[model samples]
Target: MKKLQRIFIYTFLSLAAIVSIFPFLWMLVSITNKSVDVTQGRLLPGTHLIENMKTLFATVDIVPALINSAIIAIITTILTLLLASLAGYGFEIHRSRGKDIVFTILLLSMMIPFAAIMVPLYRMFGSISDTAPFIGIDSLGAVILPTATTAFFIFFFRQNTKMFPKDLVEAGRIDGLSEIGVFFRIYMPTMKTTYAAAAIISFMNSWNNYLWPLVILQSPEKRTIPLLISNLGSSYSPDYGVIMSAIVIATLPTALVFFLMQKHFVAGMMGSVKG
Candidate 1:
């Protein structure tokens, strides 16, 4: 019976691994095949890799889109780390009704689907040029402004902050440190794992974000990788080889970020557990 159970568990794990990895393998194989061969489900790689890359570059301004994606992801990450950490620390340390209510409202905002509010958000941003000064339509600000206050990050930070030691806050206070100083010096330093986890998650989300940017960004120069991929997929009779190459390009950075930060991700959860 135990042997049968062991065999069953192994079989399940193998199946799951194959299911997860098959799509990426297929994508790689498709990249190496002619468009017709890929569409026909030729599971093996062909010698069309270089040709696919050439076609992709010829058809799309992938480099500029990559730059735009980088700018958005980097800025979003920094801003999210600063703002969300501040808010999280404030809510956890203050112990006030007002702050509690505000945090609840922020969490509630996360529950509201972005799709439902997307049109209204789009119109508000579109009129920014005429209605607001400096930040107008078609600017990077258009992409950055809407996402600056991330509700999910707020919740993540706040939950993680609950794990922080109040004794440290008291110690810092005794040393004549202000609340802000305690946060920046005492709390932030010890929460490196939390920050790493948040940074990875925020960076990936911003980097991969599509629908909002699709609605807000107007020019090809400002479009993100996902948007670029979408356009590539929509072209008249898209060459699967070229599309696969583009997917590979679009996926690499996020994969790298995830791999580098995975240890921190686990560490962050452990911090939360220790709280």
Candidate 2:
């Protein structure tokens, strides 16, 4: 019976792994084949990779799109981590009614679909650009502003913070540290795993975000990777080889970030659960 169970589990896992990885494998195969060959289900690599890459780069402003994606993703990840962590720690440690209410509202915001809010958000951005004293429309800040406060990240941090040792905060306070200092010096250091997990999630979302970015960014010079990929696929006649190359390029950053975060992410989740 135990042998049968083990066999079943292994079979299930193998099937799952294949399901998850098949698309990526198909993408690589697509990159190596011509459009007709790819559509006809050629599953092997071909000599077309170099030609595909040449066409993709030549027809697209690949460099600028890549730079814009990297810039927005990195900035969004850093700011989301900082702000979300701060708010999470505050709500958890302060233990006040007002903050509790605010946290609940923030969590509720997570349930609101982006599609429902997108039009109003676009209008708000337009207003900010038109009347705001400082920044204007068509700026990168336009892309960054709407995402500064992410409900999901805030909730993730708050849940993780429940696992934080309050005794550490009390001890820091007893030692004459202010609330902010205690958060920075004591809590932050202890929650490295939590930060790692949050950073991964936030970075992936920001990096792969397409709709808001599509609406906010109007210039090809400032387009992101996802937009570039979509446009690459939608030109007069799509080139499967080139589109496949773009998918691979666009998918690499998130894959790298996931690998780096996975090492620490599981450990953090385990720690939180134990605490």
Candidate 3:
């Protein structure tokens, strides 16, 4: 009976693994095949890999779109890490009345769907376009600013911050470090794992964000990877091979970020749970 149970568990896990990986495998195979071949659901790799890549590059401004996405993702990640960490550290380290209430309100904001605020956000950006064109509509700043630091990130950091030792903050303060110095030199270094996890989440979110960028950006040159991919599929006769290639390219950065920081991310999440 035990042997049979073990066999069943292994079989279940094997099936789950296959199901999870099949789409990525199929996408990889699709990139090598022609559009008709892809539509026909061919599972084997084809000889059209270079042809598909060449066609994708020759036809689209993928490079600029990549640059735009990288810029937005990197900047948003940095801002998120800095701001969320600061807020989290303050919330956890400094004692104050009404702090919990404020934090509660911020967390509650997370429950409100972005769709509810989309119209107002659009109108606000539109109103400021003439005064702050750099951050207004049609700019990458417009995309980054709205998503730079979300409540979820703040809560993530705050939860993780609870596990941090308060004695270290006191030690730094006693050692003649200013508040800013304590944070920059002590808190930041001690919380490397949390930062790594937050960076991965923030970068991925910014890189893949579509709706805000799609609505705000007007110029073709301002398109991010998601927007560009949408356009790739919007054509009357879409090239599935090229689209698959584009998707593969688009997925690489976030995948790389996650894989690189995977260990730290797990540790940070575990710390949050322990806290």
Candidate 4:
């Protein structure tokens, strides 16, 4: 009976995995085919991959857009993780009524739709442009600054931090480590899976962030991959092949990140459950 159950589970999982990966496979196949062939639902590889790539580059400044995305995502991820972890540690370790109230408020803020706050956020950033402006309008900073720290990530880290061993922290302090030192040396190192998990999630969020960036970055040159793909789609005569190629390119990094961090991500979540 157990063997039969195992067989059924394995079969179901294999099917589910194929179902999940089908769209990615389709996208890759479509990238190689020409517009007409793709429109006709051609599933086979074509010789037009190079042509599509060339046309994509010709139509848009893809290299710069890719660079822009990488910079924004990387910088935002680093800052988000650093700030969120610190905030989480603070909330978890230093128990105070005020901090509890603040954390609750922060979580509540996440429930409010981003669209509701977008106008105020736009005006605030725009005001910066109108006033002391270097890293304002249509800049990478505009995109990264608004969402450098996410409430969800803060909450995630805080929950994980609750599972962190307090004894290790005490030991570090006993060895003459300052509060900051203990966190940097002891806690940070011990929470490897949590950090890895958070890193991938935050990086992907920043990488694929569309709405706020679409509003903030108003220039062709400043566009990221998502924006670039959207613009391509809106053109009078869209090229499916090139668009597919662009999509595949845009998607690779996030997929790569997730694959690398899958083990750590699962371990981290399990650890969180233990707390």
> How would you encode candidate 1's per-residue C-alpha lDDT over 1-275 as one tens digit per residue?
99999999999999999999999999989999999999898999899999999988887899999999999889988999999889888888887998888888888887788899988887787677787733566777778877878777777788888878899999999999998899889999999878988888777889989988888888788889999999988889888898899999999987776677778766644543354
- The window of 10 residues in a row where model 1 has the poorest summed lDDT is 266-275
* TM-score of predicted structure 4: 0.89
**Which segments of candidate 1 are over 4 A away from where they belong?**
1-5, 131-134, 266-275
TM-score of 2: 0.87
**Clashing pairs in model 4, backbone N/Cα/C closer than 3 A:** none
User: What order do candidates take by lDDT, descending?
Assistant: 3, 4, 1, 2
In model 3, residue pairs whose N, Cα or C atoms come closer than 3 Å (at least 3 residues apart or on different chains), thus clashing, are none
**Number of the predicted model whose TM-score against the real structure is largest:** 3
Across 1-275, the per-residue lDDT of candidate 3 in tens digits comes to 99999999999999999999999999999999999999998999999999999998999899999999999999999999999899988887885768988988998888989989999999999999999999998988888888987888878888888778999999999999999999999999998878888887777788999999989999999999999999988889888999999999999987786688788666655644555
Instruction: Give lDDT: candidate 4, residue 62.
Output: 88
Better of 2 and 3 by TM-score: 3
State the RMSD for candidate 4.
Answer: 2.9
How much is the lDDT of residue 210 in candidate 1?
94
Q: All candidates' TM-scores?
A: 0.90, 0.87, 0.93, 0.89
Candidate 4, residue 47: Cα displacement in angstroms equals 1.8
Which candidate comes out best when scored by lDDT? 3
lDDT of each: 0.85, 0.83, 0.89, 0.87
Model 1 deviation from native, Cα RMSD in Å: 2.4
- Of 1 and 4, the candidate ahead on TM-score is 1
